[model samples]
Target: MLSRRLALAVATGAVAALALGTAAQAAPARHGGHGATLRTLAERPDLLIGTAVDASALAADAPYRAGVSSEFSSVTAENAMKWEVVEPARGSYDWSQADRLVEFAHRHHQEVRGHTLVWHNQLPAWLTSGVADGSIDAAGLRAVLRKHITDEVRHFKGEIYQWDVVNEVFDEDGTYRDSLWLRELGPSYISDAFRWAHEADPKAKLFLNDYNVEGVNAKSTAYYELAKKLRAQGVPVQGLGIQGHLDIQYGFPGDVGDNLARFDALGMQTAFTEIDVRMTLPADEAKLARQAQDYRRLLDACVAVRGCTSFTVWGFSDKYSWVPDTFSGQGAANITDENFVRKPAYTALADGLRAAARRAGRH
Candidate 1:
């Protein structure tokens, strides 16, 4: 749960009031700057750059062009594929919007990275309310979960390149978050989710995604243990997604490359997923500069790791970011301002990628 202070900020829309810039200043509604689609971004020899987008923001006739384009080869849905949006009710499914999003990506020649199949947040009211009775029989819960995973993965099939099979399973404290899955399926629910996803879409890569795992710490250690155990059992887990939701004021973890290497040694691909460096509101030159460097560090970490596959920002523009709403005093987590103007961090990221490419070629 978000802290009470942050929740209040989200509720009052004060965060939204602090818009990045007027839409009039934004660049013409078009695809990404690098003239690349999500798939192309992923194919880059360097780090894959990407951002999340809402389906309603782009035009249906040419959604790919008018939307925030990235050199990123892979695109992830912000929330469209989550349980709440996909299967809002028990047994009943609503794949209409999500299918359209995936179809749009295919039409535009992009690879869709399924945001998540299982998560503790944004659950449907029915599921949460049903579990409230505390009498959720194991068999019933398992059947429901299995069916949800089976149908969704089967539905997407070849459209999705990767699936975040289990998301935010661990809390900042390194223990499994108190979630329904833990309550019903024990800790093994995670492996089950991954196994089910693979069975449903054998070709799709499976990733374990979470925030606060960018460095060696209690949370990362927990992930390391889980990854090690899963790999030893040949659990078919394909990758690890380090969510880079950073804060410039709070010094970043210096051993990011080391941590990522540890995961790579486990034989799983690594990705910087949901990246955005937030700072206290009222951006200053120093804060912006630090934010740029923060981005460089994250990109550098990805470049340093051989198996790191992609790097994705949670959102491309401050105008569309979920940060301000999700966390108090975080109005500038995006690389672009409200008007779609590139921020200094954008340049820093491009520079980092170019440097990494040059370094890779030297070898």
Candidate 2:
């Protein structure tokens, strides 16, 4: 089972080492001038500024650990908490990588964001195969899912502050995603997920996280409707997580503030869950400068909104960015370069928070 686990992880990540040269282990631990970290610059103490952590990087890479501990107030297990990594086999679950991330966060006084409980991607081969081949029936699959949520949540009950319970469950057209869960259990699976997660850890704030819903689009509107319906039915849904994966080429999502406000009006908490403004490859200073402005705009919107809580970057450094591997010729998606040097975008983010602090009568 562990062999199966190792094989799956290797299959997905074998290209990272080649794509990204040797680790930035030599990068100095300290960042920014005068020790004005994001944690300290954040005038709103409740606002958590964070980045996702790759477990292998966190383990073998010193600079990586330094970046996470020195900068962020929160950390999300990038892939460690996903089903494939945690439960590689049906009955075999490995919490070592995820547990290390949690323990590391604890030692550094950082809260953890439990990445996902329900997602179509990164599912165990066994689970997916069983479902595809009819070995796992609807009722049986539901029970299996319940066990996962219950065991995983209970395992890390007090450690995690927010759980991206159901991720990317909606399509871009405001329709339910054609996921394994949707295929088996239908749309009710969404609410069922929230209920099961709540039953496991009553205190952990639950969020429905998705990308392409950063603005008031059809996708986001669909989420708003679903959240409203779930609330009406007394489901314990607490947050709407907008994954702000922006591309500088597309300009900024100007309506982000209004979208957050609508969810806020629903007595729901909203977060810019994953904020990264990427650009086309061979990035010039001009493109980087535009990236800075785009980053500032998103942060400013969150700082202005009452219900906007955590602002998390997908990853903090270009060296470990997932952009290039996933998107051809798009790599500069983080606040820092390969050497861990802070970029213009990094300055813009800090300045945005400071600007928010200076603004009077923010209601």
Using TM-score as the measure, the top candidate is 2
Q: lDDT for each of the candidates?
A: 0.74, 0.84
Clashing pairs in 2: none
- Using all chains and alpha carbons, the TM-scores for the candidates as numbered come to 0.85, 0.90
Off by over 4 Å in 1: 1-47, 59-67, 134-136
The per-prediction CA RMSD against the true structure, in angstroms, equals: 10.0, 8.8
TM-score of 1: 0.85
Stretches of model 2 off by over 4 angstroms after superposition: 1-32, 360-363
- Candidate number of the best lDDT: 2
Q: Residue 250, candidate 1: how far off, in angstroms?
A: 0.1
